[model samples]
Target chain A: MANLILLKEVGEAMNKAAIDAFPNECCGFFFGHEVGEDRVVQEVMPVENSKEGDQRRRFSIDPKAYMDAEKHALAMDMSLLGVYHSHPSHPAIPSEHDLKQAMPWFSYIILSVEKEAVKNTTSWQLDEARKFKNETLKQL
Target chain B: MAQVIIPTPLRKFTNSQARFEAAGNTVQDVLKALSTQHQGLKTHLLDENGELRSFVRVYLGDEDINFLQKGATPIEANSIISIIPAIAGGIV
Candidate 1:
């Protein structure tokens, strides 16, 4: 499995954001560079979940927010490697909706938030079959 | 001529080229030139009805074209157009 390298502090920050969002899902971006088959995360940028109605089960980054993040990544000289989102009260697994919405070439880091606490963290990527395969998450 | 910056995900359709210079007087023209140059990119940027996909956001300079004149937004010779795909998903 491919691995994604994240700084301990960066990982902690994602966890905190997940917990903070609580009953609702939290969405964000990860700015990083690719090292061979592995991705090294340098920053975690949280964005507003623009999905209207039932935010707890869904999350969508506003078009403006996505553009802003792209510019920010460009300014920082980093690639928008992937996205991170929390699944409130659900496991850190990519749901069917995720596979349908996801594009190739970006990693997805999912945080499992259970009762205002983080439970598990998992990373995923969409395969050629449009299914998500788990990626190893390494925090250092 | 306007420079359209293609996001990383869509670069594969452009032969992995990040940015390409296209000739047009408006956002629509430039996009038309882009799709004409890279035939594989047409569907990704536009749907069957030829409308920009909901997940695909096009910006004329720093402003989203949607807030401007949309596809009819005028462009300068050196204008920069950026294509950003929305990052979204859900637990369900």
Candidate 2:
């Protein structure tokens, strides 16, 4: 099982993404360094959602943005640890569609916003069976 | 009797029974038995097409059923099966 840590930086990043995606969905990638006791998220990239016109506001990362993220991750010796997305009116739970598309490795984070303010944040990890399990996040 | 371990989020559908005793020679049969006991659970696990829902996952102990035979995977009377669903949430 992979351990999860959400620093103040992560919380702030999530909030920012939520605010940015107000009328639509906001999406981003998380980059972090593996320190002794925690994975410190050092960078958050606010990217344009490729699926901008969908009513769901669900997004897929742009290929260009994805490539750039991969290059940056390799250079920084960081990993593409998690994905964060904003849910404008829904709760922060993976939908049936989300699970079907998720990779078995990366963590998935969801931020729920009500009236442009963040209501809740949660993170999950896909187990060996592709099922999601709750991950504990400690702020540093 | 086989043991079925239900994840927390799905417990409300199972009447709060974390684990259940079932009888079947295969995973599909066991799950069918479970759904019969708890109405609406099968719908949650399987979509209208009767295929496993994308977000729901099943494990035989530590091994995932997907890598094995899926619903056709054989089960021993004493084996433990677990059901888990993917969860997502954060700031809006």
Candidate 3:
């Protein structure tokens, strides 16, 4: 898998999570094996947004939730590939705030949820210079 | 004793030390020792009341200290601790 390969089932689950949390940002984790440059996603871990206020425009993954997700990934013998989140009423693009918080090497999947419908889903990666580079997404 | 791994964002306060060993029977003790070694780490890790900063997460292995014992989680010699900042953001 030279590009980001997301299993069809996983993609649908993420879309559902995005639509279900409409008007608020939904966040989750994806994990699977990494063979060369291809990241094969096999699992999806939806995390609750722990931000205290304004869930619509902001999403925060609690460390506890992260730890739990890591435990699950470990149990499945999979590595953490990246995080997925939805932007309510917005485009499937990384925002300035997202760029500031993102780390290199991890894939960031952004879903655009508008009017309670998932319109688009895109994946991105951060380069060495800390710039967001769109990743080629293969939904299979 | 325990080994605490520092993240890149907070490395400047720890002299770029990726990992360091500190003496402590509990996570609290280890963090206290670490703060003493690097004065700048205290504020980033703990609030004025000496509690863990809201945005700072201390993990013992794969378990969060907040779910276990907060700062009082007991640890063995090989206990690995990781400090991760809460990541949150959105365009206004």
Q: Give model 1's DockQ, 2 decimals.
A: 0.65
lDDT of 2 by residue, A23-107 (tens): 5667888888656645566678777767745625566665446545655766777766667787777788777666765655466
In model 3, which regions exceed 4 Å deviation?
Answer: B1-56, B60-78
- Best-to-worst ranking by DockQ: 1, 3, 2
Q: lDDT, candidate 2, residue A115?
A: 67
Candidate 1 per-residue lDDT over residues A38-59, each given as its tens digit: 8999899988889899989999
Name the top lDDT candidate. 1
lDDT of 3 by residue, A1-140 (tens): 15889899999999999999888899988998877888899889898988789999999998767666655766777777788999998889999989877755578899999866799889988765778898889899
Better of 2 and 3 by TM-score: 3
Per-candidate local distance difference test: 0.87, 0.71, 0.83
Model 2: residues >4 Å from true position, as ranges?
A35-38, B1-92
* Pairs that clash in candidate 1: none
**Candidate 1: deviation at residue A30, Å?**
0.6
The 10 consecutive residues of candidate 2 chain A with the worst lDDT sum are A62-71
- Worst lDDT 10-window in candidate 2 chain B: B83-92
Q: Write candidate 2's Cα lDDT for B1-92 as tens digits.
A: 99987644355677756688998998888888888888757767877777778766777877778899999999999998877553332221
